[model samples]
Target chain A: MNDLTIIITLIAIGYIAGTWAEKRHYRSIEKREREFLDLPAITIKNVDIDDAKVKNAEIVYGGAVISVDYFKRILAGLRNIFGGSVKSYESLIDRARREALLRMKTMAPDATMIINVRIETSTIGRKSHKKSVACLEAFAYGTAIYLKG
Target chain B: MKYTARMPETNVNVTPTSPLREFFVLLSGVIAIIVGIYLLLGLALNIIVPRIPMTFERKLAGPFINSMASVDRSSEKAQTAQKLLDVIQKRYAKLPYTFTVYLQESPRINAVALPGGNIVVFSGLLEKIESENELAFILAHEMGHYVNRDHLKGVGRALVFIMISAMLLGPDSSAGNLLAQSLNVTEMAFSRNQETLADEFALNALHGTYGHVGGSADFFIKLSKEANTGLWGHYFSTHPENLKRIAHLKNYSRIHGFAEKLLRNIPAIINKKRPA
Candidate 1:
């Protein structure tokens, strides 16, 4: 096939597949997020609950690594040249952070609240040969609290 | 009564994981984009090069050639050089510009064709040539550069590379050197095609001048032997393998019946006299 046809087909596939996957992921995240509303996760420095009300507290953590789609990568590369915000990469990081937080919540399903929640992000699969970032790991850690009966 | 302050709070949202399938899709897309850009640039250059005028090319090459060392016209090697050049020039008398051959005093076995029909022949190459036919082949190959106007195309490409590098990497940037090195490699890649075309032109010219393609591959055959033991062998060298060129010449000669008129044991006529 001709170069133009091949390039067009690649771009089309990237756009359609990338958009569909992102939307599906967001929907799934939203449904899971609704289920975890009762177990509120917060980044506050300290919890206000009385010591008598706190039965037990333990550290809980969740981590995940997410890879960016080709469509988003191409957009990010173009943004590098023009010098502006890369919205696609922004979404990619957002998804990773949220996924990490959800996993942390899953670890303490019976806990009343998780406090001092922190998120750390790092890049993975960054080989010298590939120009773009392959994957990003997001780790979320917090102290889970169980209220006394 | 004192009012109680509400505690500062931060909300947490879950992010979805990216599937393995998406990574492959993105990688393939990026590869396609890179390939597309490379093809486009190649197509543009192929179309643009031939349109450039010869006068502009001469002006561009003039300074570079002037800075190189040249041999004195009174030298005995220069006299022999002129005789070989005269025969080639007579064959191509209809060339638009005046053709002149300059003998360089260097020991490097090389020849170069500059713009405005100026050809430079190294003393080492002259010493290594076994017969007049071999010298004629070398001269004709250089003439092929003039006919195809490859020098101009090379200069144009170099200027483009420099301009792009300067724009992307500032003048003092260390990356400028890297860019230049890559450009040199690309230039060498382009030379492979030009070299093949020049060889064809040389073969036809040799047949016309000597009534055969005899001794045409002698220089390349000798070089192939030396190339094997050389520090910078044909593997890393810019030009194609010498053995491949020799085989090509032999095949062409056989197919065209030029091998039938082969002249054997022709002694070197130019090296008989030494300069005073």
Candidate 2:
């Protein structure tokens, strides 16, 4: 096939598959976020809860690596040329960070809150030759504290 | 009831958001603006470059060409090249500028035209031609660039690109290097268009000189045979595919009635002694 045909096919596949995947993920994240609403994860470095009142406390963490779809990759490539914020990528990072925090909350179900939550993100799967970024990884970690009943 | 410790399952979210819509809209807008600017600049240059006096263009380009490549005048190959240039110059007597052809000893099969009326023909290109007609086609191609003032326009565009890049990237950064590289690819597409126009010039000039445009595409035919190594071999190249160029030359010759007078036998110039 010619170049135009190949490019059109890629864009079509990326749109259909990427849109479907993104929609499904958003739904799942929304549902779980509602369930985990009471489990607050704050970025504060210091915990104000009284030590004597705390019965159990443990470090909890969650991590994830998400691959970018072709549609977003193509858009990001265009953004690189024009030099601007790549909003598609921004959403990708957002989903990853939120998912990581949710997983950490799930780990300490008995805890009142998860304090000093930190989210760290980095890019992966970058080859020297390729123009588009492949995958991004986000890790969320925090201290889960349980109050004495 | 005793509490049981249970591991939490990791939940991975790979969801689409409204930002995807914004990404495509913004990207399309940016691409449209870039293309609009490119077209405007191209049109402006076409009108401005040809009107610049030949003497002024030569004065501006001559020193740069001299500094970039060493001219080889004493070699036997240079003498043969001079002979071909002399013939072409005589055939196109009413040219706007006096043509000065220089022979540069290089291994790459290429020729280039610099502003003013200077043409640099590489020794490697000279050694590959099977006839003086093929040589004439190459020289005429360069002459075509000279006639159309493409070299000066190219320089003008380069300066514009550099200035814009400097303003956008600042100095001494890796991002600046990437910007330069991307700009180079864009500039190459512009150069390819100029090459196509020059090819047309060469075709007409060859027909005028030899009564036929035969051998006008010999160099391109040779290059096409070596072009297919892989997908990326010639994809982003500045020159159009050699096969495409040859096809265009043939098409031009057919319409101009020059195809009927094609030479049947190869010229003896191919068997000339190599410069020691």
TM-score for each prediction?
Answer: 0.54, 0.53
RMSD of every prediction: 11.8, 10.5
> What digit string (tens of lDDT, one per residue) describes model 2 on residues A1-149?
24446666887788788878877987897788878877778777777668899998889999878779877787777777767666667768877887888888889877888888989998888888866557888899999988998
The number of the candidate with the highest TM-score is 1
- Deviation from native of the Cα of residue B164 in model 1, angstroms: 1.0
Tell me how far the alpha carbon of residue B196 in candidate 2 is from the true structure, in angstroms, after superposition.
2.8
The residue pairs found clashing in candidate 2 are: A22-B15, A22-B16, B58-B116
Report residue A33 deviation for candidate 1 (angstroms): 25
Candidate 1 chain A lowest-lDDT run of ten: A1-10
What DockQ do the predictions score, one after another?
A: 0.04, 0.08
Report how far residue A61 has shifted in candidate 1, in Å: 34
The lDDT for every candidate, in the order shown, is 0.71, 0.73
B142-225: candidate 1 lDDT, tens digit per residue:
888877777666655656656655664455555555546654775677888888888888888877777778778888887877
